[model samples]
Target chain A: MKKHILTGTLTALLTLGGLSVPALAGPEDVVVENAWSRASIGMNRPGAAYMTISNTGDEPVTLIGLATPLAMMPEIHETKTNAEGVSSMSPAGEIVIAPGESIALEPGGLHAMLMRLQEPMTEGDTFPLTLLFDDGGEVTVEVPILSIAARGPED
Target chain B: MQRRAILGYGAAGAGAVALMLFVGWWQVDGPGGPEPIGQRPVALTAMDFRLTDHEGNVVGPETLIGRPTMAFFGFTYCPDVCPTTLSDISGWLDDLGDEADEMNVVFITVDPERDTVETMAEYVGYFHPAIRGWTGPEEQIARVADGFRATYVRVPTESGDYTMNHTASVFLFAASGRFVTMIDYHEPREFAVPKIRRALEEETEGAT
Candidate 1:
């Protein structure tokens, strides 16, 4: 009787383990690469984040939203230069990436405007950025903060 | 015939009024508009200015006018635009070689509240050795920006914080203190090198 009871309990434990593994949601097929941002100056100062988003799979993806714990609000902003070379910055909605392609968000183009820092960002410090996609994919990327005038991570 | 004459006079009077309005608008709003980018469309009459540099010494038109000078208006907090432009300027100076000595690059802060003299000094040093940075009273900075016909507006964010939208063009002045031309905000070195070489050559030609 004792041997039979132990076998039944072992079977039940294996079944529960199989069920719990599927409960954890995995990140959808998307890759975020080379994320970096300039360090903010003070509490009320605004800093910018730049990165390259690649759609590695055959299916296209659209980036819908961005959130960060470091800033009060994070949104997509594009800097446009007119034919006369006058630049204007405004909020950009969503950006779509085709299959096997990537979109680079850099200066004078699409970028993430991190607004109103909760605290000063120091060099070498990093923060978490959650990128929301149309495929119900949420990818968290670690963006390392560089100096006040850092053009890129290599700098 | 009387009605025809009245109509003709009325049309001519209306045309005259339209022409007058366009001229008035162009003077304050068109040619000298808030943000004049690219090679300056017209030669801007240089205005004399008195302000301090990073060294705390008083610098004015009297001190700065004698050499070929380049003035850029931007804030320190500007990560991408300002640094990219400054880096490009550094490249221009590097391309100038010894001709660089004849030209001076100065960075003036549009956001004076944060871009103190110390800030400007540190920021400018990152690019090139000869670059100078300046900041002063808000009115003084405005006067200098106005003198160049540049525009900079404060843009408020969602959290009541603000960022600056400033004129990113680089202004070039001749040794005569007259506006020579503006190197479009981010003109490549190939495009900028020739224009700057010609300007430097002209200074030499004028001196001889």
Candidate 2:
């Protein structure tokens, strides 16, 4: 039962990685590293996933989708603030990775919102996740879940 | 010989009971619980505002009154401060165990344009479910922010994304909703948990 719940939560967070294909797929390269989920305890519903993405190709590549067996749906998302002094989170259409550059999806910034957990995420658990890019290429990664208290602001 | 043995057993039992009581009392009054802020006492003032939770419920100061409340002002879009702070609160609550039941945790959105009741709820839900989220109309939110002395400003970027710069502090209120102290953003566990323990103990003692 616990395993099912953890899987469900990861599925919800990974659901955001899916996006429409971009017009130009300049480079065929994308790499994700250090992807992990924020640790939480009982009755906690949603969590955030963080990682670093590196584009090693000569041309820029866009990350469009993410997938994992843990969720029902996944979509690309970004946090944006409006003029009325309100901050909101919405689906990111595409995340562009420049050539030889890396984007850090750390806390307080662009992160994967793992929504609608099937189970509570305890500390010391790991979930398997996959990142899908526009050029039909994908990377499989393991996200370690840690205690919410252990996560620092910079992480 | 039998009578002497009974007396000895009675003495041992009494000693054991006394030791247990001492340990229990020490744990309750230990240094790890909430402590009073030695500096200026934070004043809790009431402000009326409208905001929503992830489940789309209306929330304001009134919702925080029944229990000792720990409130923080932040936006869901904050890249670093908001999530880390809230995550710390969640961890502290876990460490608190049953003590959390007597406290109400609140996350107030400074940016209400995007943080409708539903959005606030969704955002807050990422943390512990016991934490309540509130955000209302812009004017009302502004009033509440001012009352708490929390600050927020929006800066625009070329990519069509904007960032909000705001003060990050957790405010603790008595069960009666009087301001207690502000937990600095960086050391919530070290600073905030002890204050919460102190508040709960004080409330319990007062009731007795």
Candidate 3:
């Protein structure tokens, strides 16, 4: 509720401020917005990336995997909390985005899990992450590293 | 003779009724009456386990005594919830100002195989200075988790590696080592800080 309003307002304000969003690469029909990640606590620990991927084309697209130099292994993982409040993570296999549909990989849910980071992801830093699709399409987006406690990109 | 036997049975039945009423009243209103609803007295110190802190110091339940303690369970490999919760705790400690010194904020790792003492030291250093990370033998971790009423499981992922599924709530304890309440995952700062304050308040009340 409030988060949606805040995000919408932030997007509107950013548009009004004349700040352009990150440029979409490869297939322009697939839009990636709010690509963001948190600073890692240590170089040895893992980090995460989140964003909303919208497929505006006439056909469905499957997100196959992710690639980044920041970490040794970057894969799509889904964090699930059961009824007992025990949270777990598992590899999220290729996610299919239907036409005119959007898939959001957010905190406490589906996200790009970066394992064994080469260096600590510090605040105020940016990195390039390539998202691969099953159709031989790829999209590279610039992910801004925010504070470790940041809940969203705008935060 | 039959009437006398009947009278004796009736008298015994009356005595039994009186005894039940007395026992029921004693449980409800006696000197050692039942605790108020939702107030279950839990002694956290009763859990006996030993583990080394990030600083390589062997610590047990005794270390938690004499301070309001906050403990959470997770793995260092965890990317989202663990770091987010730790950062949130750091913010709470910042809001506490000088009062934070009197608290014990601990992060216990369920994945002892990966989270060594050195790993924990570097990990906790990123958060509040007051935070301490604890890791030990897998059996000891299990013992501590059992005592804290927490749970965790090792889940194998596709990359020939594994992840942990663990309890996500932060447990609070009073200075006397009595279990307080829990702060759920992603709980807002407004509610989380007050819970910590209440644990501190318990110490004040106990002092006098």
| The best candidate in terms of lDDT | 3
Worst 10 residues of 2 chain B by lDDT: B33-42
- After TM-score superposition, the amount by which residue B143's alpha carbon in candidate 1 deviates from its true location, in angstroms, is 3.1
TM-score of each: 0.73, 0.51, 0.75
lDDT for each residue of candidate 2 in A1-155, tens digit (9 for 90 to 100): 45434543544345334221211112335566566676643432345677778887798777887776554444445654333223445566688888999987766457765554556666666665666677766665566676554464233
Cα lDDT tens digits for candidate 2, B1-208: 9999999999999999998888776667656433422233234435666666657776667777757878888877554467777777888898899999888888888778877776676667678777888777888878777677666777653335565666666778777667777676545366678987877776666567
Q: Work out the iRMS of candidate 1.
A: 2.8
Tell me the lDDT of model 2 at A85: 25
Per-chain TM-score of chain A in candidate 3 equals: 0.86
Q: Any idea what lDDT model 1 has?
A: 0.72
TM-score of structure candidate 2: 0.51
**Ranking 2 against 3 by DockQ, winner:** 3
Candidate 3 residue lDDT tens string, B1-208: 9999999999999999999999988988986575543333256678888899999999988999999999989888889878877878888999999999999999999999999999999888878999999999999999988787778999876556788899888889999999988887756789999999999999999888
lDDT at residue A119 of model 3 (Cα atoms): 88
Docking class of 1: acceptable
Distance (Å) between predicted and true CA of B119, model 1? 3.7
What TM-score does candidate 1 get on C-alpha atoms?
A: 0.73
* Candidate 3 C-alpha lDDT tens digits along A68-153: 88988899988887655578888899999999999999888899999878889989777778889998877877678888767787
